[model samples]
Target: MGVGDVKRRIAEILREVTDEVWARVAWVAVDLTKELIRTGRRKIAVLADDVFQAIGLHKAVAYVKGLLGLIEYPPRSVDVVVAVVATSEGLTRREIGRHRWASHRPIWNMPRDGFIQLYGQIPGGKPPFEEVWRATGGNSKLLGELYKAGWSAEKALREIADERKITAFVKTLRDEERELLRRAVDDPDVLFTREDIPLMERLADLNLIVDALPERDPWFWAGEPPPERDPELGIGRHIAWQTPLHREAVRRALGG
Candidate 1:
């Protein structure tokens, strides 16, 4: 859908969504998180992409904004926070720290056991959902489409060709793929070969590129930069502005 179409749909969803739908999404995400904990995973990192699909960002962000307010003065549970908050950015450590009125202290304690029981009890609204959906829901469809199209991360990354929006973190890579790529780059003696399919696959998953050698391809290792460049190499060299004596008029313009 075009930007206008998306905006209209989101406005509609916010105006008409029921509490049942809200509860269902929360339940699914919480259940998945609980399972991760059960499997001995200490930290359950959920990508907000799925929730953004279900609910638009304007509504989602509003929900989170409401939750944050409730969390401060009234002290809401983290599970409730997850239920209302759809995007990952809202749940940052800084955000959590800013919610000062919460009766319950924030918990980041480690060594959490396999059975970490956390309860969530908070009602929706007390804030409008439409506002939250608008901010976070825009890219939901595109991301979902790429995943459905059998596009690898590397493929998506290459096709998109913009790292600023996508490469927010390195954990986007799968464990095996990360290991393979790390090994390929770190060991100079090890030539990248067909055997490195898994590594290539991983990079593909993250939307990065790794062109074939092709007798000397410029893109052989395109996305990655050489690791050993000196930090101070560019020290004390050129002037910030490229003008000799500020070029007559330029100096007058700056009131120098």
Candidate 2:
């Protein structure tokens, strides 16, 4: 359906619901519609789907807006880049550009605001720290939550891994996928082959796992000139739990 039609239908649906229900849910759809409209994209249908899905997930509209406001609003390119770096540490600029929502422009020129740190300096006449990028401090916390939430406000709200939601989400996983999550919990460094790509991607979408490099110690960058190593050496990705709490919750759900 056309974007206008989608909006009209959403309005009609909202009107049909009681005032109490409308106060709780309809405003979310309305605000999301306004946000989508500002992007000038014909994605109202998708927004409509997300709105109801969010309601079904029992997400508060404030929770949804808070997460989206942090990572998906105006200047989304910068936030997207930040989230990419947040989720996967030790990424080179080239690697950051490879993510779904990332672009070369943002990678090259985005403001770091002290949230992002680039390591590995080049000798001369080159872009600073072409080697690896990492998100720092509270920015990392917020971005990691937003990223692990799969950029979905509904998912973000549920990321705390409440028992009921975790169980509900776990029930939707395929056998192999559950096995994979189990393996990851047992060995955060678990390796996967080409055949596992689709499963890994799906699990990633559910915010159950992330692919990341080993974290570098703060002392590694403490010296006068700081230690320099070949960024290529440790760039291999490893499967990891999105958070310790998420791991524990999944473990309980999997009965491990």
In candidate 1, how many Å is residue 149 off?
3.7
lDDT of 1: 0.32
lDDT for 193 in candidate 2 is 67
The sequence of per-residue lDDT tens digits that candidate 1 reaches over residues 1-256 is 2335434544554665676565445434444444444444443344333354355533544434544443343322233322233222222322333555322221111111211111011132221322212211212333343344453334433434343233332346566644543443323122245676544434333323222222222343222222221111110111011111111112222223
For residues 34-123, write the lDDT of model 2, one tens digit per residue: 455556543323222233232433333343343345356642233131211112221232233344443222111122443343221213
| Winning candidate number (TM-score) | 2
Clash counts for all predictions: 29, 0
| lDDT for each candidate structure | 0.32, 0.43
Cα RMSD of all models vs. native, in order, equals 22.7, 15.2
